[model samples]
Target: MILHFLGSRGCIDQRSSRHWRHSAMMITQGRERILVDCGEDWLDELDSLRPDAVILTHAHPDHTGGLERGAPCPVWATPGCWQSLDALPVAERRLLHPGQPTAVAALQLTPCPLAHSVRAPAVGLLLDEGAHRIFYSPDVAELSDPATTLRDVSLYIGDGASFDASLLRVENGNLCGHAPIPSQLDWCAAACVKRALFTHCGEEIVSGSHEEMNKRLENLGKERGIEAALAFDGLEVKF
Candidate 1:
């Protein structure tokens, strides 16, 4: 399985060479391609992308705004995401039941519910291709079940909204917003995940020096006993 990062910037005005566009990832296995999210940055570029299928993590504009003009292929999302995207012109809509693994483009995807936005609601995806497993959650306040969701996962791709300070806020008593990188590293360490990469970069990462941030991330990962780094646009990883 190969992972291609199309964009890494979060929903913010700050932009750098590495994190210029909105967060999105493309997973490819041979000729089959599955796009994880299509943000506003990719609105006019979908035709060229020509993905076999698109899997959305949530309905936030940064995650689903590209489908405003409709999609060329099937679009998959959780029930809650569908509710928020009902007005969109997406032709083929597929339902992703939480915790139920579904095969798309030869990859098994399991949607694990997450606490991020109260209005939009979100889920982290568990991607498996028999030999390797990866957990991807670009925006998350907390995972519903980190232990179960990350079990046997070799790589964890998570939110980079903040490095150490929590971005969470109490919204009607429910947590909302992205979790800090340090906390996510703690989760990875708890799950024994050895490799981790963070995308959906916030202002802290986008406006800071990449070299400095890389060193900080490496040091933070060392403290947690995990190897970690920041993911950049156009970066590709194979497993």
Candidate 2:
């Protein structure tokens, strides 16, 4: 599987040449092309990417607003996510169930509930092709089932709203906001996942100096016994 980070900026006004667009990613396996999240920033250029399908994580504008003008391909999301995207005239709308792996094209995707928005529920995806497995969650507070979701995961991609400080909040006993980077890295260590990449960048990463930020993540990865790296727009990795 080949993963591409099309956008990385979080919900912030801050922007830079390297990480200006909202969070989105493209997955490619042979001739199959799958896009994850289509933020408003990607609307104008989405067609050019030519994905076979679009998988949404949540209903947030930064994650689904790109389809406001209708999608060029099939759109897949959980029931909660469809509630927010029903107004769009997408060609095909598929409902994804948490824990039930859905085969699309040539890959398998299993959604896992995430603690992000109560009003607009979110899910992280476990993508697999035979023995290769990867977990992707651009905006997450907590995983509903870490034992199964993180099991045998080769790579973990996650939120990067804050580097070290806590940004999580409780809303009517529900968790919202992104977990700190250090805490996420700790999750990677516990999961026994040897590699991790962070996207959905916030000011701490977009506005701060790149060299300093990379060094911080590098040192953290070294201590955690995992390979950690910050994802930037247009960044691509093959697994």
Highest lDDT against the true fold, candidate: 1
Residue by residue across 154-231, what tens digits does model 1's lDDT show? 999999999977789989999999999998988898889999999999999999999999899999999988999999
The C-alpha stretches of model 2 lying farther than 4 A from their native spots are none
TM-score of model 2 relative to the true fold? Answer: 0.96
TM-scores for every candidate against the unseen true structure: 0.98, 0.96
Candidate 1 residue 24 C-alpha distance from true site, Å: 0.5
Q: What lDDT does each candidate get?
A: 0.92, 0.87
Clashes of each: 0, 0
Cα lDDT tens digits for candidate 2, 10-123: 988999987889999999988989999998898898889999999999999999888888888888999888887768778799889877889876778888888988878999
